[model samples]
Target: MVAKSVTIDFEFDWGSRIKSDYAITHVTEKLLQVFKKYNSKGTFFISTETLPNSEKYIKMIKNAGHEIASHGHNHTLDYDVKSKMDLYNQIEKSKKLLEDIMGEKVIGFRTPAFKRSRYTDEVLEELGFIYDSSTTKSKMRNRYKPMQYANSKKLIYVSISTIRDRFPSGIKWMNLFGTKLTGKKPYIIYAHPFDFLSIKDILKLYDKNKIPIHVLLFYTARIGSMLNTLANCIENSQTIKNIILQKNEK
Candidate 1:
């Protein structure tokens, strides 16, 4: 059977530069609550370099029965990256950090900014990763071409695929409208705490008349739009329920 899963790749680019325990702690709890509410099991793509400061949160994730995976050491974007060696270094560093935190061998990885390059395939293979969810096929020239590297082993990229792949819409459109364009496939969604935390501030910028317009129309559509895709996934995906029940049991 085709396994259906919801992988939650969590982390903020801002965290690597400035260690904010408060932000980390709050987001961690919020995630735990989300898990409990949905009774969902997710794979957290984490940065090992910052794991030391996130011990409490890491344990919360694990204890709550979630799978911990690698995001990378520095949240570095592979496409923007300078060299293959740099990619390898980040993967290796991230693996070590995750293993140390979970006290278990790590197997999965997601790119820092959903970014990828030729180096992405080589490094994930070298690092012995079982699966990767980094490819977005967005408008980002460096990232938009998944078919270019489709033959790479166990590299699972996400995009919206339907309507005969006519025009990417909904979640798939977000990345397509950006730097890369991708076909929709199972919809692997990603977000940072700041994505949600910055909502109020973002809406406040608009005038009162515009606030409702943006809030009900644009803002809601832009953020958490994945929930619909996720709901579709949850309804159709059998493994997700099992994973969640199994994790919650622990």
Candidate 2:
């Protein structure tokens, strides 16, 4: 069987980063329902800043048998990061907060937007993070094949697989258009909470007038069968942390 890892960037809604936990409060519970139906597990790279009132849900996720990883404190673009210290602050604070909530160490880290800087690897290593899933083909200029992070003794950088050998194989497109899984080798697949949000739930969060007609149509397409498709992938991929450990044991 082919090796695969399922990951979710636990964060805000569609385009805007409104200071709310609607995704966590609503979408995640729905996701958990689907995951339960499939007997699936995954790594949720949570944004610590948004995890204030959602601690119960975080604990619920942990209790439901999922790995909690760091998605940084604020879901900001790393390119705008002024210094390595800034990046370190974001990632470290996030890790600490998650560990505090779950009473477990968070060794895996994935940048909010896969926007890693030149300082990313060094900062992650310094922070003692073992598994880094922030590396994608376009962002890190890495290969589009199954491989490991080279040279690093402690940090294992598992680059996320992409579609068309370019686009990151994430939720939106995968739901609308399926991924062409070719090889029997292991690969990484990622998702976000918004991808599983229903149109009614989305309208509850966003003003219906502001959301375009086409967007609403795509939202419909994104749900239903495609949403179930995501659950199917989750069942197939299992927990990403397990795959990483299995890789290291080899």
- What CA RMSD would you report for each candidate? 7.3, 3.6
Residue 236 lDDT in candidate 1: 26
lDDT (C-alpha, whole model) for all candidates: 0.55, 0.72
Over 162-184, each residue of candidate 1 has an lDDT whose tens digit, in order, gives 22243323232432343122344
Q: After superposition, how far is residue 202 of candidate 1 from its true place, in Å?
A: 7.4
- Per-residue error (Å), model 1, residue 164: 11
How many clashes in each structure?
A: 13, 0
Candidate 2 at 98: error in angstroms?
0.9
Per-candidate TM equals: 0.66, 0.85
TM-score, predicted candidate 2 vs. hidden true structure: 0.85
| Displacement of the residue 59 alpha carbon in candidate 2, Å | 0.8
Over 4 Å off in model 2, which ranges?
Answer: 138-153, 182-185, 208-221
